[model samples]
Target chain A: MKTSDFIERLAEALDAESSELEGETILDTLEGWDSLGHLATIAMVDELFGKTVSAMSLRRCRTVAELMDLACGEVTP
Target chain B: MGRVLEAQGASVTAVAGYVPQGRLCNEELSSRYPEWSAEDILRKTGIRTRAIAAPDECASDLAFEAAKKLINREDIDPEDVDLLIFCTQSPDYFLPTTSCILQERLGLSTQSMAFDLPLGCSGWVYGLSVARALLEAGEATTALLLTGDTYTRYVLPEDRNVAAIFGEAGAATLITKRSDLPGHGAIGPFVFGTDGTGAEALIVRGGASRHPQKRRRLEMDGPRIFEFCLRRIPGLVHALLEKAELDLDDVDLWVFHQANRFMLDRLRKKTGIREERFAWRLEEEGNTVSSTIPLTLESAVVSGQLKPGMRVGVVGFGVGYSWGAGLIEWTHGGMQ
Candidate 1:
């Protein structure tokens, strides 16, 4: 999936705005950045990229860029 | 369901489940966590009230209650019970196997073979698989497969993560070696899968040799488990159908483990199994680990949802990343 598409899907997953969820956006500041949000993100990334992200990695991600990088790395690797 | 089966051994003739008297209704949960309402619990999990075992109640207590009920209700002589298998992640003690205690308490003959199986949601089918193999091998004619777990014992009452999802219960399933006219509830055509790599996905880290210092509390990653179920269960269903040489429509009832209502509904749509064909009646008992499948069967039997001459597809998945599936013909009509 393209970065832009991934951003939109991730926004939907986090229940945030696509425009607001830029690469630099702090994921913790989002309204849906909680346990359920982690679940949604995990599901969305696995569904879209065919990669399973460990919960620990998601917990470690500080920004949208890092999360995206993790998914991209998993998918590309 | 219409296909005739060859004479089979080890048919399940009776099933009974027992839940402790304690109750943890959703109202209480909503009171504790304002964000979660009673309606939300019912809507999200399809659980109204969860059965909790009292502090004094252990897994064996629940198992004994159910086993006694099945024995009396079905007029099964304890001596006739030649094989007793208890499946549980929670045992009365670490030294003596709980199955041995159950055998003596239930008045089964000392000669009766008794043992314990350590598994969670994947337990019932595994127990049935072993019982079927043993019975077919002429090791025993009567087999009683009992499953009981007090998961709530370890789950922190305040930890909504797992407390809300688990309930305590025990169940007894009687698998007798019989080939009378090749009728329903005949047990066979089994498929098993396991992945020890995902052992940490759903686990209790405190009790065993690895983490003796920590308390035996259940910790789970909901998303990981959800992904596992969504991705693997469809393959499991397909594999079972292929082994049985039947399609989804041939199944009279589809009873997956009563993990939760959401997962069951999602799997139903994902697998394209119709609504009426699936069973999701865990409104009272949340998730009883190994006992979920058999408890569901007992409930179905009482409600008349499960009748004789029906081909039922049963799958028990979770914990150990382990799973077992099989297509069985129901033959418990006369006993009920």
Candidate 2:
């Protein structure tokens, strides 16, 4: 799935509105986005792409776009 | 107490149950209990294998899974739950209460009533009674009934008395307004009674005014507890059936708290109820304290044995010499 589509799905999984998960919204800036949500996001990423994303890899992504880039294998950091 | 809730238009929007992942299957437990193989032990205890919560996992964790499953299914809005009753003896915190934490995690409204009932075995039935009453009294439109107990937290693993019996799990049900559904009935009269006098029969030596957590370890009088259960449960069930205007013959299914296979089988023989009437998951779930009844019922529904419109009698009896019985008029069919 596309990065935007992935972000939309993540928003739904987190029970947050799609608009709230748009680009430039730093992952840490989102309310109710806690450790559990972080773990869930990683799991969702693995489920969508038949591969594992390391916690170290997830930490490099500051925003949803960056996370999507990492998930798409377009960006290593 | 026995009006048909489903007949009044109420619907069960969701049902969920959870068992921890650290498995103690029949093969493993039988190795520890030499006289009994896992199968024999299951035959005796009505449990083949049981899931044990990790040291860090608490009752709240199991309840969280149940709530999460229900919410993920999008069957009912968390805010729609007006009452959240966590029936468990093992609360995550000694002071704050497990139900309160679940309320926050589930994002239930502050207006909801949240409380933890520190009871064992019969807790699910007691909770269902409370939920039904709340709905009937118009105290709330829907109630979330959750039961869980991490008993291993209180028991010594080496204590053969409880080790062979207790396991960990959680079960949840969304009880909504009563409606006139083909297979559902209002909650039945709950025949509940407690014999606090025999509290020590199956209790932790520590963790109360008497034993405080600092001194915590399970100290059970197994023989005495077995004797007490045998004597008390049948009479209790009889009383409950009479009160509910039901006879043993009228019950299409009997869902008993899986205290042990021996106790349940004996109860079945004594009650003159056929083996088919009982839903046995002991070989799979063991004695999950408060969650057993609901979990067994859920398992039966999921496995397709319990059909819709079946009149199921639920009996919970254990610790504190506490016991309760309730009738669940199946309004819906198999769990899809």
Regions of candidate 1 where Cα sits further than 4 Å from its true position: A1-27, A30-33, A40-77, B1-8, B334-336
Local error of candidate 1 at B51, Å?
0.5
lDDT of 1 by residue, B1-336 (tens): 332324347788889999999999899999987767788667666788889999999999999999998999999889989899999999999969999999999999887999999999999999999999888777788899999999888877567757778899999999986766455457769889998877998888997899999888788877678777777888899998999889999999988999877667766776889998887668887898999998888777777788888888899999989988998898777444
Task: Say which candidate scores most in DockQ.
Answer: 1
lDDT of 2 by residue, B1-336 (tens): 532433243444457788888777767766775644565455445666678988888888898888788676656678888799999888887889889999999999888989998888878888888887777666778788888888877676576557777789988888887554534655676788888878877777666776455667767665455556656677887897888777888888999888777556656765667887888777666788888887887788888778777788888888888888877777655454
Find the candidate with the highest lDDT and give its number. Answer: 1
With candidate 2 superimposed using the best TM-score fit, by how many Å does residue B224's alpha carbon deviate from the native? Answer: 1.6
Error of 2 at B203 (Å): 0.5
Q: Candidate 1 has what TM-score?
A: 0.86
